[model samples]
Target: MTQGLAAAGCEVTLLLKAPVKTDRLVAPLTGVPGVTLRRPYEEELLPDLGPRGLTPDQAVGLITRLDTENRFDLVVVRGRRAAIAAAQAEALAGRLWTYLTDVPQNVAELTSAAVSELTDIAVASRFLLCQTEELRDFLESSVPAACGKSVLFPPVVVVPEGVAGSGTPHTPLKLVYTGKFAPRWNTLEMTELPAALAAQGVPAELHMIGDKIHRDSPDWAKRMAKALEDTPDLVWHGGQSRAEALRLSAQCDIGLSWRAPEMDASLELSTKVLELGALGLPVVLNRTPMHEELLGADYPLYAGEDIDSVADVLALAADPDVYRRAAERCAAASAKFTLDRAAERLRGYLDLAFPAAPAGTSPDRPLRVVVAGHDLKFFTRLADHLMSLPGLEVRLDEWEALRTHDQYRSKELAAWADVVICEWCGPNALFYAQHKRPGQRLLVRLHRFELYAEWPRKLDIDKVDAVICVSPYYADLTRERVGWPADKIVVLPNWVDDEQLDRPKLAGAEYTLGMIGIAPSRKRIDRGLDVLAALRRRDPRYTLVVKTKQPWDYWWIWNRPEEREYYERTYRRIQRSDLLADGVVFDPFGPDVATWLRRIGFVISTSDDESFHLAPAEGAASGGVPAVLAWPGADTIYSRRWVHEDTDAMADAIHRIVSEGRFDAARAAARAEITEHYALRRVCQLWTDLVVDGTAPERIQLDRFAAVGLG
Candidate 1:
């Protein structure tokens, strides 16, 4: 990755984990134009740390100190420990881009601890770097935080010059294997391939390059040592330079890479295979999914686990026609992983990660704006973001109740402000619509609750410049209900502060489901319970956590006989069912929802209808996957992937997501979808354009709105 970035003309400083003596330097990066190797910490700093090198806290301190001095645009760290350390440390929050190379090889190897660690890194980093598409998929599936953030930054295969295969097997066909002799890699097993091929009436020799050997088992090591010394057709060349390795490998008829089943299941592609293919040598490897994608299923050299399978494949490769076809296929496949291609990919990722600032200039004086609302809970972040803008001066006109406000203060602020924005289309909106002056712009945001009320009909439509709805579904509904002009209404989604909400998930969060606000009977607490019952039937670990005020707390709802009956019946059902009795938990409502969401893995929305249910969206922004019932107009507000038709489908989706080990990927997709459509920054831009320039949101195109009856 460093080489590819350097090749793209970036001045990259490569930080060594432990201090290395400058006198003993490798020749590979000696002349790289834009690369520098820096050992910031001295040997004395980590004297007794052994081969493990720096601990997470030690790494954090070292990186923090170095970052302060260098002021780096991006800090690229590799491995789980380094990424977790960087993510948890406030000093390296926004700039850390982790290259995740040391994760589990497959879903079976993906443990709960690994998932939690990766999730922490995913939420904190700018983006997660993947070496292959398979690895990217695996990472994204295991860690929800990695869904939209994971990007491909594959290994750069530098092909040596003047090395090419003959496209025909030699008289005594030579087979070669490069890289370490590890137990799982099956390097020791290659010693038997030549003799096995000879039994099939095909003469062959096995050649091995690399000095490193992982002596994992004493018995295997002893057998490997004896084979290297006594095997007639085997030649072991201990650790040669790249140039020497390629030159020696070029002399061979085929490259050998078949490994043990466990190693074959890995999501990573072999760089050595690409290197051999760059020399125009066909590779004989295990028939894994990644290998099939790389060389194609018809590449002719794929082998299974048994020695006979490898031997059979080697004998088949001895045929000139088969050898030439395999060689061509491998060379074509390897072309995509060249150093230059890697450099181009790196440049593209960098361009997106650090885009050029958009051109703009501030106004002569800040525009005076007043936001009037009875409850600004939904609009506080939007108000705060607007105030931070360069050319905006904002103030709030707080009301005592929905229909009651200080008349004198409202008039004074209205007269003083250039623009007045009524957050809800209630009495405040009516006052602004009736009193709007010639030079003043009055905008009313109509939520679903206000649409049900008489506020829209009572408002002076002629004086109001524009009415904003949280979704196009609501916008169309409002237009029909109020009989407003085609162009009088616009659609802008409710905002979610992604930076504030995208926090690390707590351990065991994947099994904990959450539901927010079930005040009215229509919010569908029963449906949520049904879904929870279904999930708990499959896995007892599944539990539902409800965060809301009790039904009795709402006077209007509790006073109704139907509401009381519904609660009584729901309580009786929970008492009867084993799944519901122990699985349901209700916590008191509080303002600290962001903190509360850390323990929730999935957020359920089983409402019969909604304006733009902000709870699920907020949960998504907090890295929790939303399992929503397909309520009326739900598709417009959320992606169809998140909306299930019934409780059964919702339960099925939640179960499949967890059982298939794609909870992270599913949650990430939800989070990315919500953040992209309704982030605070994007909504603020729309508001600024409307408040300052009197421009309609581009999404509210005249033709599209007219087609959808929102014109």
Candidate 2:
């Protein structure tokens, strides 16, 4: 990968954890053009962190020192510990591009610890390079933080030229295996292949390379040693260099990579198999999903765990026609991993990771902006983006509750700020407005819930410079309700982190309907139930998956008699209907909504009313089509096509989307819309203009098709 990046014109610095030996594989990369190798042990007099390897502290110190001196564009780490160390450094966390192969790669093996570990690194990284598509899919589905940031980056194969070969089948087919002889690798079991093939009336020679043996079991280790020494028609060459391995493999007709079932189910593709394929040799491997994707399901040489399956594949490989076809397929599959192709892929990924800034977009003088808020959930991502901007330094003054905060901290932050952004139009905004210093700018964002409270009425609008609203309708409403001037109101739509939300949907997601935040009785959980029943009546496969906290969990909402009664009635209706009862799944609320949305094909927003519903927009960002009911101002916020008149119409729209086999197309279009309008980049740019440039926020119109017929 280092060589490929260097070849792609990137100034690469390959940092080694320890000093390299003369015979090491990486020894050749030293002093290469466009590549500078750094051996930390040899360069710095560092204390020994632990036995035999670099510790996280050592890695952080080395990387920090190097970055200070050279100012690298990106820092790529290979393992979990290194990524964790880099993530700990606030200075370099945003620049990390992690390629972690050390974690559990398959869904079945993924544990909570692994997900937590991966999430920590993923939240801090600019990109993640996955070695296989299977691993990428697994990560995106299991780790919410890993969604949209991962890209496929399989092993690069540099095929040697002028290898000798013959199209005709040999009398005795030659089989070869190269790598460690571990129990799960089935290297010991592979020695029996020669005899198994001979018993099946197909003569074969088995060549085993590599000297690394895992003596996990004493008896098995002794048995393997005996097999290497005395097994007929089997030759053990121990271990050899890369060139020698290829030369030895090219001479053989077949490469043996079949392993035990545990290893067979791995999400990773064997590099040795691809190398052998690059040598123009057919490889006999397990029929894994990744292997099937590489060589196609019809590839002739797939083997199973048992010896009989091995013998059957070997017998088939003895035929010239079958051998020729397998060889051609292997060669074609391996072509994608060529060094030139890998270099091009690396360059393309770099372009995506760090897109060029627009011309003349120079940074302004440094600004210290303090984002003071009681509940900053909706604005946290915006704050993080602001911190990433070139000339801005942002800090958050988090409050204890909606109206409670540390007065000392809040006062200190307000006094020191060039601009103070009150996330919610509550006590934070009121306090900042009342305590504004001379030359200090104050901006307060008001959402739907804040308008109903007395805080906005009590807030002194004269002291505030601008009041931000999520929608134009809400902006006008806020101005009328709070008596703020039209010039003081700004309509900044809530942003969806499109990159974080967009991910590959799981199979059967097309039948799943999703609802987020069905609380307070006003969100209309009953209406969502009606839609689910309507859909299930047409097809029992349709199901509703609701992700939110139970209404009782919210004290204020549950305390209201109407809200409690509404939920009880809704539950009874669900329990009464057969189609609706078993078809609905209630998942507890959590932060991993990206992962949760993988199984959701449609986002249902059948609310009684909303100022600017964000769930459907989030769903659209995640490639799930939105089925929004025609609430007040719905057409202004969303395309008319997504806003249906009622639950029945919403159900019909969803059914039509599925029955016409246009679910993929519909979701693609929806995702494109979200990317164009509500994407984080566009909204971030608007916020940057408001905060840094002191540009007045405007009441912008959405739904470009509002004046036209339904689209």
Most lDDT-accurate candidate: 2
Number of clashes in every candidate structure? Answer: 2, 0
Per-candidate Cα lDDT values, in order, are 0.81, 0.83
Give per-residue CA lDDT, model 1, range 1-711, as digits (tens). Answer: 777889887898776666553332345776788787765455354445556556777777777877888888788888877788888988787678899888887777788998998888887887788887667656765566676577777777886677787778897899999888778888778898888989999888898888766787878878877777789999988778887888899998899988898787676778889988989999999887678778877889999888999999988988889999999998998899998998898787676555432224245666888999999978876776666566677889999899899998999888888899999999999887777778899989889889989888888899998999988889999999899986999988888767557666766788888999998999989999999888998999999999999999999999999999999899899889978999998988765566678789989899989888988888899998877788877878876677788999888888887888887887787787778778866787777778877788765322321132100
Clashes of 1: 2
- Most accurate candidate by TM-score: 2
Residue 693 lDDT (model 1): 73
lDDT of 2 at 434: 85
